[model samples]
Target: MKKKKGDKTMKNLKKKLMYSIAVSTLLLGTTIGVFASWSGQINVQPPGWGGSVVSWSGVTKTSNSSKFAISGIKESNSLDPYAQLVNSNAAAKSSWCAIRQGQTTSVNDNTGVANYIYYTRCKTNNLEPNSNIISYSFNPY
Candidate 1:
């Protein structure tokens, strides 16, 4: 017996649904870490509210293939980085802190940006407690 037009449409819809599911599953499964450099330190949060970490920036040097990295950050070089983040938001209370290349502590000093213009450079491991400054920045979301 010939299939009805409605039945054919339903069958087509079912096939499309199955294909979509299969493609999604395959894409997710095959994506077992095809992105290498993408595994770097990347974490962006809202400005926050009510003691929810208004805005905290982090910078660290990634060591090894996929493991612990040096937390070297200095305050002397916190000028541009801190200012960079603050400038992005005129009403941002930008606070800055850096961890040592291999240690976890504020190396140089703490920088603050009570008000900003529109320039925030979000780069990590760009400086060290006992080393020169490393410059890095990114686009503000």
Candidate 2:
């Protein structure tokens, strides 16, 4: 018996459908595999709102130096480190307390742009015994 023309057409249609499904599956698998192993680097610019906290240390009457490190900071016009000796006394109503002896090698104290570690050394006069906090803050201008 000879095969009919309609039967051959039906067989060809089935083969085409199967081939299309296989190709689609292979393409999807390849796309997923390529995306699964993706590795990339991200660079963050300096933020506009917040400042960097370089250092924090407790202050005492004795001489001590507080060191803070700087990292990942790019060049900017107003990037500098600031050091302050704070007297956190609850009883003392006066906002202004006795000044203590201190020195800072901050970028603000320098002539040009500086990047790296910053230090602040303070020798307490011990006049305001309640004041015992040294704060170092970094701000962009």
Candidate 3:
């Protein structure tokens, strides 16, 4: 049987449509994978301080990548307080690094006493292959 000219055009159009759909699906999947992220908070306290001095530090996985970021905000009466990010694994203790030093500000409350608040900068670090867990330390130094 002889094929009409329109039949050849229709066949080429269908091929192009299928290719476009397949490419779109693959790209969509990869885009979603790259943008996925997770986040959590850990309560931390400065050494020698009691539970009343504890603060929640924010931590987040940087968009499904092997990296994470941390930030801390604490209310204290100390000078030069800061936050540090460290690998939770004991073997990786040497990997600890100071993330940020607090930007300090003093405010007077109803008691007329000076209250100091520490707002540390957010910092990011790469995840170690065997140390996915992260711990934070708030130091009132």
- TM-score, each model? 0.26, 0.28, 0.37
Worst 10 residues of 2 by lDDT: 90-99
Q: Which candidate is the best by TM-score?
A: 3
Deviating ranges (above 4 Å) for candidate 3? 38-141
Question: Which run of 10 residues does model 1 get worst, by summed lDDT?
Answer: 45-54
Per-residue lDDT of model 1, residues 58-121, tens digit only = 3322222212122333323432222222332434323343323334322222133222222333
Better TM-score candidate (1, 3):
3
Ranking by TM-score: 3, 2, 1
- Model 3 TM-score, all chains together: 0.37
Clash counts for the predictions, in order: 12, 1, 0
lDDT of predicted model 2? 0.31
Candidate 1: segments with Cα more than 4 A from true spot: 35-141
